[model samples]
Target: MKKLYSHSSFFIFCMLALLLFQSCYKLRGHYGGEQSFEATQRPVQPTDVALPKGYKMEAVATGLTYPTGVTFDDAGNVYVVEAGYSYGEIWTTPRLLKIEPNGQTTQVAAGEKNGPWLGVAYHDGAFFVAEGGTIEGGRILRITPDGEMTRLVENLPSFGDHHTNGPAVGNDGYIYFGQGTATNSGVVGPDNYDYGWLSRKPEFHDIPCEDIVLAGQNFESDNPLTPDSKDKATTGAFLPFGQASQAGQIIKGRIPCSGAVFRIPATGGEMELVAWGFRNPFGLAFSPEGRLFVTDNAYDTRGSRPGYGNGDWLWAVNSGTWYGWPDYSGGDALNTDDYQTNKEDPKFILAKHPAKPPRPVATLGVHSSSNGFSFSSSPAFGYEGQAFIAQFGDMAPEVGRIYGPVGYKVVRVDVKTGVITDFAVNKGKTNGPASQIGGGGIERPIDTEFDPSGQALYVVDFGIMPMTEKGPAPRQATGVLWKITSEGGN
Candidate 1:
């Protein structure tokens, strides 16, 4: 066992430690928070990551910052989006780069100096991007081969922990993407405001706001409410949405904007809502069968409105269907351990909701923060037709550090039964007992892309932070590109 540090001080130490070792799976002990452990120094080489018996993994490039989206052009060049902003620092424009077979990386476009970009895709000599967390709000922009940029959508409510993500092109000549919620669990309270960068705005800012769903009927304090607690139960109703306004007052079925999925036709027009009820949907992809699938980031039990997350999920997305949020987790009725109950009963919200959202096809590990995903099409990889998702892992455990280091690797899901199986693992520094949780060498994988010939799979590693850190380090020039293939064959 190692020493433990208080969460407050540990966050500060991690922020300042640039060359910190990766400890993605080390468990935190329940003590008085007097002792803390640090990872021993080790070089992060291609060999640090592990693959199954017949597979091999290696680094293609390194030294990028906070890379997220990955895609390939017709010319065999790899394009990646480096999210420019550090969590708590000044906004820096993210970059789109073109990488060649020789490992040379060239900048394609720096969308904006102060805004961050999360998702990207290549289509007909152009690159589409999802620019998030800006004064202008989340929007999808298109970049020409020569680097000219044009905004496709704008004024999206972009704040809180998640942002607008994805821009994959569908076979029907439509561009699909995801829009995340503005507040955690549909409430902008003090916990969100404390993050400082979060704008504390309501999630739904568009039409169809007329009959949104609500969780609790009235505001009740799990802890003492303060002026900073901007929850609708504390502050007057949020603009253009909240039906009632009053501190500790009761209101009928709450109306809130949950996370959603949207699509824009290739011919170009308005962005249409395809599905709703996600918390923080981070990744989207279509299977070889032409079915759409998505990876959603679930809720946290430490927020202002605390509740146990059933787990993150991979859903076989359906148009015009509800997937359950605020009132549900992982398709089951949401746990109401901390809110005020109404006559309709807090427990039955899931049963009574008219839309009756469908459950996930597969349940990911709790707090795994599942991100990008893609379907295996090439017979060379052996798992053709299976879907692969990047479990980016969780940071800042809720309460007593319960679910730290649950993700951090790639997983393969059975399309037929929705069963999840580990495809990659990182045994960390010592290969200690905790290493079974998959951390250390692999770090945080953000997106998975397969080569045109299907002989190779590309993975974007978003670097590694100490599992104990509250969030990602402001800036670490450690992003890497990993290629995975069969060792004996392929």
Candidate 2:
């Protein structure tokens, strides 16, 4: 108790002096937000893609976050949408960038949440970006050339494991977009039995099932079931039992969200279904001749994780056609025996649908994750109708799903002949031991677009693995925007 008050006062005085000194030190430029890049010495060099002899590549702009989708206005200005981490991962924001023809890039919109702007298209003098959706789901956004953004459509179902994304402007003037399924396989019931259950478990569950299962039928009940009771008891299940019914029995069409293509009118109207039965359609485009093309990712499972034997495809999409999923892969549609059967429903259409009429226009290598494609509009390259696909490369290596030595490359597909050839390759090596490139290098070329002048092609490199285990510290900055100019062009 001896002079305790005085001792406390002395300590407080010392703390105040230290705080003042620290403030002064920060004000003296020792700290405080650091220095801007412009405040430092020279400007950072642009990151460019290395192209083959007939072509040159350069980075029109750098320092963008995760620039996934890129498009050009009719006036030749470049517009890029950034998926600020928020795709799948938490805390990611969204942004949009504008690049002038002279290579000056500026941020038009930033700090937007729930926007992994996966796809963008120019239509009707406005820029449309597919913001993978907000926390509420995916949406289509309209942005003016001056950076004003408006919501065109919202509440689109995108929360499924495989989300709704990838929007393109069709020749018909409608905006075409993708909606992906939630499950890997279109299996009915909780046990997740396949088509084989028909013969294997005829007594264990009802046999010879219909497509739509009645509700509440899977559960066992003691009472003799009445018609209304059976209907009320049937819950959507594998075998029609109790009140439960099979998937195809109750639902008129195939299961919802097995992946579908939709068209939205530019002037604002109801969204219409264009196609169904896709796994994950990442890119959509129309040929100069007005044919629709879509690149779909193959279904991946434990045995097919790396998708080595399975082939990805580019299809000439037709209206109301089914690009078989779970029921088929590559050009081979799985036999009906591969699926399960139930007793409650009859007339179950077997998994006998052809994926684009037994052939894809071109077959991309398995697990290539072929994404955003653009037909070359350039006259100099003489590739007016040729399509270029950005291959994200194979992710699984332990499964021996090797995609050649050149991992990250864009492939050019001959629309007429369905021939595929390497369009360009990234020179830098990848970091992983099994990585095709020696060192950690350019990765996951996500999207591509031709310059407004149609003289060059711009590719958006997502620049990192989509999934990473607890190993390795997370690489924070990994996205890049690259440009490839055709040979002999200015």
Candidate 3:
């Protein structure tokens, strides 16, 4: 996912000014390390990472290019998606590499010259993949056992930081996936210029009249705003996720082709919306009890539509419920600072939703850039029924100065209590100052999966994305497929 904040050099300067005046910043629980740029210091190999007692880590496959998602076949062969040649530019040639148990590897399928493949899953003799969109829109592609590929869902709205991700198979035998929006929020404004054509697509802005709201100086719409008084140009429409409006009608067809979870039968059928209102829902997993869970990337407080003061979230998904995007963060009203320039702006007032919004089960750190996660169910691994999330870490001067080193390790979330604990770390407690956490520790752990036997986990370490200005700092051919298992087989 491309972050608008990192691209904004001007914002970095402003944040630097703020940092100079501040001293003795108290440590917050959300921060993973000190608020300083860490130089990429060490080579991150399997042996260099730290693990818990009786647990061992080893590199199973090396030399991958920005690998994002991983899965395992019934026979124990590992399949990994290499988000090929990403300079944050969406180009295909992304390959689905199969790493056998014996260490042999081969490309099972390669994406066309388009965008990268962000997610993959193995089910019922086929590999389901989430192909991101740039030249084209995102789609769900299936590679059969013989390597033939077919599209299941095509042309979803994807042209910004977040792409369509995850196609996890649900208990009901449906394949579920998440489609992200074009802009950070509803209207793509001047703050999101780096996205070029994405922020200017008129078709994407089409929404129902009843869903419009008076935002900023006027009712901003994806469609070009007409010059008029705020009171008349946009009368009053429910702000979709419950922003104060003159008209309290709950409407649909808002924010075209974005921020929705969809499901389709394994045999293939029309994709239907399961839920909506996620900023960037990247990871999807199902618990042993068949409940759906998602690891969502929270808002960044930079760019034209920056959201305020809420972290990424882990949600227990329920069908047909809205999870609050543009209007709210983590089920609470989004901070007024996000949209309004003046604190006293009446637009900051809240509105009652036609339906109540759902809250996250657990809150994660802001800009942690969480991606894929899986349920740890095997008792042998000692975290039965917990979700292990791969935090890709933050990569911006603004985030590093404020939130510190947010995410770069695998975190375990207790399903029952929503309590989160660090299950695996690169170097305990001292994750930031940037230099101390890289090279040897997990630089950017992107995805986690359980082995077929459920005795170990396969972690995809997306090598060397430091939380600094010149970040997205890739350690070429440094991506590794790691195996986390108990020492001496427990």
TM-score of each: 0.80, 0.69, 0.79
Q: If the candidates were sorted by their lDDT against the true structure, best first, what order would they fall in?
A: 3, 1, 2
Candidate 1 lDDT, tens digit per residue, 188-287?
Answer: 4545544444333433332222254333333333222334544444422222233333333332432223378888865568778888878777888888
Model 1: pairs clashing at backbone N, Cα or C within 3 Å:
3-35, 3-36, 4-35, 4-36, 93-113, 214-254, 428-440
Over 1-490, each residue of candidate 3 has an lDDT whose tens digit, in order, gives 2577666876888889777546313332222332222223345456556676788888787767678889888777789998754433323368889887665678888877556677788888888988776557788898976688899888777655567889799878889998776555554543333444433442343132124333332243232233443422222222221122443333456433567788888778888888887878899999978999988887665543455555789999998887876567788766555433223322322244325578898998777877899997787887789899998876554332343457778888997898988777766455642234445557678889888787889898876543223223454565778889986544
C-alpha lDDT of residue 135 in model 2: 50
Better of 1 and 3 by lDDT: 3
lDDT of 2 by residue, 2-59 (tens): 6998999999999999887666433322111321211111122223334556776666
Clashes of each: 7, 51, 8
The stretch of ten residues in a row with the least summed lDDT in candidate 1 is: 30-39
User: Which residue pairs show backbone clashes in model 3?
Assistant: 38-434, 38-435, 42-439, 43-439, 44-439, 92-114, 236-246, 236-247
Off by over 4 Å in 3: 1-42, 85-87, 90-92, 102-104, 196-256, 335-354, 398-403, 432-438, 466-475, 488-490
Q: For model 1, what is the alpha-carbon lDDT of residue 364?
A: 91
RMSD of each: 8.8, 18.1, 9.2
TM-score of 2: 0.69
